[model samples]
Target: MIGSILGDIAGSVYEFHNIKTKEFPFLTPQKGYTDDSILTLATADWLLHGGDCATYYFRYATRYPCPLGGFGGRFREWLRQGQQTGQLRPYGSCGNGSAMRVGPVGWAFRTEEETLKAARISAACTHNHPEGIKGAQATALCIFLARDGKSKEDIKNTVEAKFDYDLNFTCDGIRDTYQWDATCQGTVPQAIRAFLDGTDFEDCIRTAISLGGDSDTLACITGSIAEAFYGIPPALHAQAMHYLPTHFQQIVAEFEEKYGPKIH
Candidate 1:
């Protein structure tokens, strides 16, 4: 979804040079999309066309092999190994990458069961760890619930009860001490809390980035859910399109036309 890509681009610059404050510009033009955006597109493409999830991930990743932050170390090695072996399998990773790229699944499926199943399938390609699958399912289900007109408290309770992620903390509560964390357990809960704490679509992203840990991935997850809830502002959506490649934009447009949540 465009929301996910927008967050990736917006937070790309701050991933390494983290800014703890939320006063920064909402969108950054200097840095483009990253592995988060690329894999998200891969997920969308897989859902649109119908194919092996791993193949799409490999194809998109290889096509844009070097993104802003580059692929995570293990994913980079997975690419290397896949290139040589022509085969891909689960790596048992619990990284936040699984949750970051699961936006489309949330929209494409109608039921909670379907959404969770698709999320699991998408994540099992590489992030087959229990936490990895749980993260993706939690994120996708949030989007599903948001678009279904569920209240924030309902969404929070469902995620906490089902996924066992404690969403009781605020972003400010963790900001001062939160350091860089790339795992699903650390990142997904905070991203959800950011969405719960947000005032709107952009606010959710800023809050996620302001948490100052795995900025792009955090914001990417939050943005996906926020877009489902608040809907992206027309100007923000159009501005974000400029940062995506032609092919990526095309997929976003097509997917949105078919399955996008109604804008608020």
Candidate 2:
């Protein structure tokens, strides 16, 4: 979870800048988390307290709303409506929203099946589209594999075979051809590849942010994978924790205590 938060914070400023190299400032004082971190913390909070999905999303979203440069218009409106009515019906959002916020599901479950189940539940709370749901599931599964010390080839093969996504894009290619894409299909695979090419956790995030498309979400996805592989460094983890509100910190700590450290 801290990995995801750190990624969001580190990538926040670069969302529109679209840099294509990994040689940029990271974890600057000006950086802060976006809706990706908020929703991930919310999901972890819900899982910890046995809170229902709708209640978790409603409470957190109402508390945070959309920060200055956060979610799309429809999603912001959906959060408002869900808070007002205390109901969260499927809105069929195919945005990378589901993928960006699913790190906790990967960590909370012990096995691949459990990971997939948790991912489905987490995605269904907001993103009901099949592609959206599959993106979350694929990301969770990748995290699980990374946690288990699976090789990059294994993770790629499993995810590519299971999900209907084309994993042909290389990091070099992403660096060559860049655009600001926020959709699940457009961003998730590139983020995963960033992690695969990374030398360490921070490198993974740097790689993702450098890919230059939906920077925050790409970093979120890469961070989740990095957490499973190398774990969040203690200094970076502490720094990331400071970005959250007190309530969110408490919730994330509770989940961490219950599930053990985010990375072994």
Candidate 3:
């Protein structure tokens, strides 16, 4: 929810002009929410009101076609086709878009199995590629585990064992070599590593951005998990909500009220 949206907005400005160092402003005057936030809200809406997840995705994309960072090229085409033919089909994409927008599925479900199923449904709408679905499930499961009071070590091991994503590396170790990779295989593990390195919610977003590869998506993924693990600071939450739309803010409020983590 707000955690994922905060990450998306905070990292929006840095996606193109990537900063490798963690020493940077958390959010700039130029920052705004991207397709990540839009789709995440779409996911939340879908979870709140039961319907075809694809329909929610298409509606959201149609409503906010020109977001700050814009939708991925393949997803753009998917939207185009869905608009023309009234058939919203999966595009077999393996992009990080699936993982970036999957935070709500983590919070909305109670069991690990249900979370994974919802995550799969979310990703398979467009990112039907095996890696894409795996990325979403892995990310959602991390949030589930974190919110369930699992230890960091437990989360790392569970995600690694379940999805085959290596959480063994650190963000600092890969900072120099990591480039702008938009793929799920390249992005999701790194995002997880960023979360693993964080001390708190804000720190997680910073660490994900410092990796400098698809910053918003990375931070979005990291922030979702971090929120479940550490909860958001009240001040930061209020500040970030100012950037979101009225509808999105409403969705966040409703979703958080019903399913958000009860951080201790």
RMSD of each: 0.8, 1.6, 1.0
Q: Tell me the tens digit of each residue's lDDT in model 2 across 1-264.
A: 778888888899888777788998887777888888888888898788776776777777778876636667767778778767867787887779899889988888889998999898888877888878988998999989987889888888999899966776778776878787777887888888898888999999999998888888899889988888888778888888887778878877887788766543
lDDT of 1 by residue, 115-165 (tens): 999999999999999999999999999999998999999999999999999
1 or 3: which has the higher lDDT?
1
Query: Which sections of candidate 3 miss by over 4 Å?
Result: 261-264
> Order the candidates by lDDT, highest first — what do you get?
1, 3, 2
Kindly list the per-residue Cα lDDT of model 3 for residues 1-264, writing each as its tens digit: 788988998899998999999898887889999999999999999999999999999999999989997888999999999989999999899999999999998888789999999999999989999999999999999999988989999999998898888788888888999999999999999999999999988898999999997999999999999998999888888888899889988998898888864333
Assess each prediction's global lDDT (C-alpha) against the native. Answer: 0.92, 0.83, 0.91
Q: Candidate 2's C-alpha lDDT?
A: 0.83
Task: Report the C-alpha displacement of residue 216, candidate 2, in angstroms.
Answer: 0.8
Selected candidate, larger TM-score, 1 vs 2: 1
Model 1 ranges with Cα > 4 A deviation: none
Query: Model 3 — which ten-residue stretch has the worst lDDT?
Result: 255-264
Model 1 pairs whose backbones collide: none
Candidate 2 clashing pairs, residues 3+ apart or interchain: none
RMSD of 1: 0.8
